[model samples]
Target chain A: MQDPLGRLAAQIGSGMKLAVPVDYGGVPMALTRAIIAAGIDDLHLVCVPTGGMQVDMMIGAGLVKTIETSAVSLGEAGGAPQFNAAVRAGRVAMMDATCPAIHAGLLAAQKGVPFVPIRGLIETDVLANRLDWCVINNPMADDTGDDPIVLIPAIHPDAAIFHAPMADRFGNVWIGRRRELAAMAYSTKTTLVTVERMFDGDLMADEMTAAGTLPALYVTDVAVAARGAWPLGLWGEYDGDVAEQHRYAQAARTPEGFAAYMASDVRAGAA
Target chain B: MSTPTTAHEILIVSIARLLRGTRHVAVGAASPIPAAGAMLARALAETQDEPKLRLSILGSVAHNFFTNGSAELFDCAAQGRIDAFFLGGGQIDGSGNVNLVGVGDYPEGTVRWPGSFGSAFLYFQIPRVILFREEHTPRVMVEKVDFISAPGVSSEGIWRKGGPHALLTGKGLFGFDATRPGFHLQTLHPGHTLEDVTAATGFRFSHAHATPETPPPDAATLALIRGRIRDELHESYPDFAATLRTAPLPSPLKEPSS
Candidate 1:
């Protein structure tokens, strides 16, 4: 039998646009490592709003071709060294964006709209850099003076990958309050999820879980990968391994240090 | 009282003062001082029997009330529900433009800070935006930001409802004037002089003949910050809260020398 986790990783091929969530939201670190081990390259990574260690690792491994993100940092641990180096070296195509614009783009995709209008980014370099984003007068305005607004083009990624705390046998994943995951899943062609455990009962049947559950219709695949978001944290399950994160931040400063850190006992031990 | 105020405490007090009279204040992730200040303001308001202040600290389960994840924060801001917010940058200029992207050039720069988060939007939506950068230096406060992550002021025809209200740094506080579209030195922090501020700042800003010093937190305010505020902050910022525990207590004033 094929390893389900490997199968899920295989679903994410090279040179595909993949959307991932923020750090506090389930990060799918295990799946990220699996993809790295598979040596996938030229992936266009999209941070729903921002990225963290997961993004840095992928960039350090020379896997990302482009990054569409608001920001990519290790939270309090500090700047994402690998990401910084890559951008500074012009290794990756950086599509700089603000948080709302990214969300607006995703929302447009989710709604199957061509674009979504947002409030800000006018007269700023953030708007200037985004050639695809346009500004137009509000057509709905009642003949009032021009009401300029930003229109963010829809962002429909090839795949959405993330980790979740639980999933039922029916493939319904309980994302709890991390509704951004739902937006990603709704907007992507395929959504691959790695959950900590399987629920015996139908998630949709339970009143409490139903509200938080992402219907299996939107989820393309689900695999049980315990501690899938390890080193990162699952909202209710455990706290992030800050020490390990700090170590990665420190070690990944230099290219050689990053390569060595990737091969060290820490990476192996995470298995 | 002879309790020497730490820089962090001073900043917290200042932030709280800026946040006063606001109905709702939102803070972003990794902001300890701003988060503490919001908490302090909320606590102070409760004590004074004022209208309840709603605080939404992103990334905190206890503090954040949004059920729709990250989008809701922006959504709330767009509707002008968030009254006040805090924004920091790699560089801030005299015109109130902020650069969170990086330095040098566009796309690929010599140095790269994190990309712009929600500042471009939040800075436009929130009525009172307090720019906070703990580092006070010429490099950080530039004459012109290499990139404008979010502009401080927009043109006359631009549809903007909000912009920079004030700028607080480690050295002092600067108030942004929308009409002149410039920052003016408002008050210097304790132990810092005008000459020191001038040397540290890269951008030119106006100041009165003698800029007043930022008032330190009173005994009552310090007690609240060290006590209830610290305890409340622990839920989101554990390490920062721990440091607050060891902060100096107010010592009784000595009798006048005979």
Candidate 2:
């Protein structure tokens, strides 16, 4: 059989806009590595709200051209060096956003709407930078007063990519409570997933799993890449390798250090 | 006699004091101090039989109750379900304006901090937004922020349910008044003088005739902090929790000199 993971990575060509989830949500680190190895470039990366090591590694590898997200940090591991360095060097374009604004934009796309009205960001510099976002008086307000709110336009990415705990042979991925992944898949043109393992039975057949399952209808492809979210934990499956994360953070501080670290046991062993 | 307190313990106690009467308090990522404070507040409430405090520490499996991912947090804030939250910034001014983005020009700033996460929306929706930053330096507590990730006060007629409630730093605490749109120095932490705060702060703030020292946590509170709170905090913040466990016990109490 053809390597579906490699095939899935091939579908994501250079310059495509890709949407990904936050660190706590399932991050497809293995797929990210595959994309990096494939030498994908000029990718417009949209973090669902925020990102962590997955984003840092991509940025360090010089894969991202434009990044749209609220924040990017390694949490306890401290700042994301490559992201900070790239931003400082003006190597990548940044669309600084707030968490809800990103979600609101995705929600608008999911709903197939032009824009969605959201509270806050009326007078913030975050609003000022994004000329795409607009503010208007609440049309629903009657006679009482003029209430103003921000409106975020829909964010339709070329593809959505993430890892999950399980995906059945039918391509139904069980995202459990991480509904933001569903929103991303719904809003994007294509949805590609990597999972730790494949569920034997049909995910939709069971009531408990069905509610949490993203039906094969929305998912375009599924690739079984066991421990796909390695170094970044899945909710119930495993804990993140904090020591490795810290090692990466320290090594990635310098370009040479990053290269050496990537070539060392960590990246090579993962491959 | 009052027990001696560490700087972190003092900040935690201060945060818990501000969290009083709040039903639900949410601590965002990278906020070990605030999370510890919330846990302490919950413990206090349970012991006192006050209304049950709903604490949500983001990134904690055992603590967080949000099932719908990051969106639900904002949605809950929009509906006014979250009562209190903690927001720290790269720069904060007297008017409560917070700048999480870097200094200098937009897009290509000289320095780049992490982008504003949920501050833009949560600052407006959550009722009690505590501005907590450990470093109380002049650069961080600026006269005016280069960029306002979230404004302290919105324009007239704009719908805003929340704004800055208090500003806590390593040195002291400042209470924010939305009406006056300014900050007032509340109390200085132990070992920190008003002069020390004035020297470190860039923004001007008003203060009463005699500023009192922030009260040290009692023996019971200290025990709870070292024991139960540290263990609870370990789930998400292992490094911080470990430090709390190994932290040397404070020296015996000393008389306060006027």
Candidate 3:
């Protein structure tokens, strides 16, 4: 099998839909940086619910053409500077969504359904804006006269990219309760994961760990990159680096500062 | 030894009061005050030996109960499991509409704050949604939002179990009526008058002939807040909890009526 970069180059390309975990920290930071380094452009990035430093860095690198998600910020680290700047500059297209809307869309894809009905969206402008989403009457309502609800279309992305704690040689990844990663992996065509380390034994050997493992069938390729989800947390492993996040939030305020930060912080470590 | 309560402390306690009987309260990411308030309520309930109050703080390892993160939270809310949730916006209107998308028209906007994550879903599904915005100004509370991320009320025939219950600003508190579908001035914060609330508020609201000052947290409440709540809040909101620790003592102007 080819290396991670080779696999990525073969799978990912311009105009493809890429999905990643939200900033609750399961992000594949190193692989995202590599995508930026590769200078991939016009990509449609879907941050499951939201994104953080990874979204901002890729946006700063001019790799993202459009984004579909609910919010992107460092949260408590003073918000997302680069993303705010990009939006202010009107550089990227946006698909504004709420948390459940994204989840419903992914669930629809996972179930191989055309769409799924969700609650609590009909009154919001989100319903008004999304041409792809439709509202249908609930046929099963007891009142039965009319019960309207929103239907979120399935989101079948081109790729599901993320970082995890570890992966066995068989490609089973132990996600340890971040089940959204599994949804993303199952709903996409190609799944590329960067890992903190390789599991010496079969992750699925034990029933307890197997409950958390995403089987190799869904994962197209696994690349081992120690500290892959750096500056972001790796559940059951390490905490997010608050100091680096603070520094990145501060430095990413301006284009010049962001460039310098990328050179000193991102590029140096990425190499 | 006596300790003075800061405005933030008062705010936290006030929010906790709104959450008195809630079984499950979920705090969204980037919300320090709401998160602290939920934890305070949890701590106070524990102190009273009340039935356990489960608080699911988004993105926190220690406090969060959901294994599936946002998905589980959404599912719980939809299933009527979440009792209360919190929401904020760049612009909130008289009718309880919130704008977190941006300031100007859609497709193109002037200012862009973070997009709405689950506010609409939770606002519709959760029975109680406390709208909290620290900056209570015309700019923040607008007459009409440029884009409605999640609406405050829904038309008939739409399934909605929840909507805005109350709106808490730094200066005052207002109760929302989903039926009448407007806000009513409830209680002004100490040191802030009705005129201050009106001047700062972008939308119109009705009020009683004489609005009373919102009661400050009692001594017992303050003790629980400063001691247990502050300590637990550090896990999810370390910096905000730090601010609570270093917060200056309450000024003499608004000293509790002794």
Index of the highest-lDDT prediction: 1
Instruction: Return the lDDT, model 2, position A86.
Output: 94
| Shift of residue A234 alpha carbon in model 2, Å | 1.5
TM-score of chain A of each: 0.97, 0.96, 0.95
Q: In TM-score terms, which candidate is top?
A: 1
Tens digit per residue, CA lDDT, model 1, B230-254: 9889988899998885435345565
Pairwise TM-score winner, candidates 1 and 3: 1
What DockQ, between 0 and 1, does each candidate earn?
0.75, 0.70, 0.64
lDDT of 3 by residue, A121-209 (tens): 78678878888889888878887478888889999999989888899999999888889999998899799988888999999899999
Error of 2 at A5 (Å): 2.4
TM-score of each: 0.96, 0.95, 0.94
Instruction: Encode model 2's per-residue lDDT on A1-271: one tens digit a residue.
Output: 5467778889899999999999989998888877877888999999999988889888888889999999999988888999999998899999999999999999999899999999989889999989888999899887678898889999999999999999998889999999999999999879999999999999999999999999999999989888788788998899998898889889999999998887773455345
Q: Is candidate 2 or candidate 3 better by lDDT?
A: 2
Instruction: Report the poorest 10 consecutive residues by lDDT, candidate 3 chain B.
Output: B246-255
Where model 1 places Cα greater than 4 Å from the true spot, the runs are: A265-270, B246-258
Which segments of model 2 are wrong by more than 4 Å? A265-270, B1-3, B246-258
Docking quality band of candidate 1, CAPRI definitions: medium
The DockQ value obtained for model 1 is 0.75
